[model samples]
Target: MLSTKRAKSVEVRSKPGRIYTVLTTLGREIAQGIIPAGAVLPPECDLESRLGVGRGVIREAIKTLSGKGLVSVRPRHGTRVLPRRDWSLLDRDVLNWLVGQENPDRELLLAVQEVRSIIEPAAAALAATRATKTDLLRINAALTAMEASDSQATATAADKAFHLAILDATHNPVLQGFRGAIDTILSAVFVVAVDSVDGWFDGNLPNHATIARAIEERDATKARDAMEQVLGYTQTHLSKPKAGTRRRAGRTGAGRTLSQT
Candidate 1:
């Protein structure tokens, strides 16, 4: 008679708090593009045995990542990474990890800026009309820091805080949902533009001030125009395609990874 253990049926055990490790390891693989998107993950029993973990731990880890838009689960389809577009760019942890990936592509960086152009100005206008006194104070404080800072990193920090404050002022979760993409765009745009301009703070403060003033006045059109100016400036210096470049895979940066969200 064949032993029962010889059958493929599996048992899952609950270890301590190590479930997070499995999640992170999977997250890192997702980030590094090691595992391509749309690939179905192994079954629970298979994954648990391969990862040397209990079924409970594997399930929890999968749930955590799934909620973050990193993985998808279907009864017949198993689990898969969502497409990059479906990824929650607003997730702070996800944003940080994506940015930290090696030599991320410039086109991807520019795409982030394009997404910002679509979302941020409207958010700013909304904030202008809706911001409370406390929100205004926070906005002013962030602007003050940016205006006073002489260093690139410090100024970028201030600029980032300023935008975040504007988003918070809107008090609309839908509007606020683009925070991670906004932050990524700001960071990458600053990195790119810093090379072409001297004293990045000095170069940008005028535009920032104009935008802030328009927001303070609750002038939606003016705010949008000012935002347009900022985007125009960025595109002028950073978004241009060189003469010899191809459509895709042309940029000499770490290329994009295709994955499920």
Candidate 2:
């Protein structure tokens, strides 16, 4: 249970925006399992007293959370935290809250990678056949930015842009519509995966360049294979090692280099 003092401590440290503060506080607590799923939130009056917020503010916060599938409310019963599977995991705020945790959920991270494996390779294959000059330019530019990036932040952004550009090159609205979801997932995963391994961004540069070059050459098969290789690096980095296993120096598992087919 979040005590009045603890809630107030969060409130004081929060930014000036009241509703956002309450929302983020509650959301973080939920994501961290501080407030576990299937638990009922305190009454609005209790929340108002605890967080020092108005009734209206609490209501609005709950409403927003409900929209994000974090909780469900009923007139007779109080708001109940829904199961993790119910969450709008792709929602920007929700994804940020989850990723921001001290130890992010491993399952969620793996799930994001699985989603990428299913989508990006096909998108790259399509881009190889359908990409216009402008689309190719954007993809190459993002790849160049990745190679030149001086910091992790820039590298992550450039990497995300490179993948999104391929989706755009597909010229399929359904695939294009995935941009927002893809951006959200990539933003979260890159922060975790890239930071976990030193030189990860630089190490993956060759694979990214291969993907771009394959697309430029209009080689759908090669583009798809290259994209799979890129995702293979992701799977290796994100996967939990067995108790007795160890990663080899200077290579991902299986002695695979980024540029290798």
Candidate 3:
């Protein structure tokens, strides 16, 4: 695991890789909406000082940005940020790290969830119409692993694999685009919130079974609804305050255990 200090030092490397790192950091800032589109970048000298690199390194990083369609360089003029669509979002590495930046914005989080809500169900529906025998087997393999896992961490990884398998069944280029969004959002949410929730893994067996059965039956409607129901139930279960914890109890005059209340 890269510690925060080490991660921040991504620019300390040499030559080709160093320029790539600098471009990636600046690109990340642009994607996260810190460096607004069409905003003029600082002069090369200032950028070199701020980025703690040589002037040549700054020039190389800017050249990389231009290559990536992130910046416009003119004749004897300054560099300017380009539109977001021009940036290579299809670059998986960009999407992977961009979503896990220091703090993802609330709007970005909602964008990811909204994309999932739209795409995952559609993918499941398409999979119902077109999945191969091997696709079903792959998904079921993850299901079996999830069912057998006793540890919270292993169960969560199995859960991720199961969803990715569902996406793999779609066989449509467009529907297949949502896999990374799901992975990054869930990873970040698990780190920041879900991993700390009590009873998150305890009641999920039945939920998992229901989802697996729907997929096995190749029932699109059932699979879609079961996915939504599982997500909703898990959210509600995890949202409750745990018993004997210092969280302010409601007006019910009793502090009930989360699942018991």
lDDT of every predicted structure (CA atoms) = 0.68, 0.79, 0.64
TM value for model 1: 0.70
lDDT of 3 by residue, 75-108 (tens): 6768998986786553554565456754444454
Clash count, one per candidate? 9, 0, 0
lDDT value, candidate 3, whole model: 0.64
Q: Write down the worst ten-residue block by lDDT for model 1.
A: 252-261
Off by over 4 Å in 3: 1-16, 31-39, 45-77, 81-98, 150-153, 203-205, 231-261
User: Per-residue CA lDDT of candidate 1, range 1-261, in tens?
Assistant: 355654423332234456877887787677567777888777899988888887888898888879889899888888998877787766765665565444445676666667777777787778778888888888889889876664556666788888888889889998777776677667755554544433334555677777778778888778777766666666655555433422221112332211000
Which window of ten consecutive residues has the lowest lDDT sum in model 2? 252-261
lDDT of 2 by residue, 107-209 (tens): 7878877887998999999999999999999999998877666554666678788989999999999889778777777766654563354445556778889
Candidate 3 lDDT at 232 equals 61
**Which segments of model 2 are wrong by more than 4 Å?**
1-17, 240-261
TM-scores for all candidates: the values are 0.70, 0.79, 0.66
Cα error, residue 104 of model 2, in Å, equals 2.3
lDDT of 1 at 261: 7
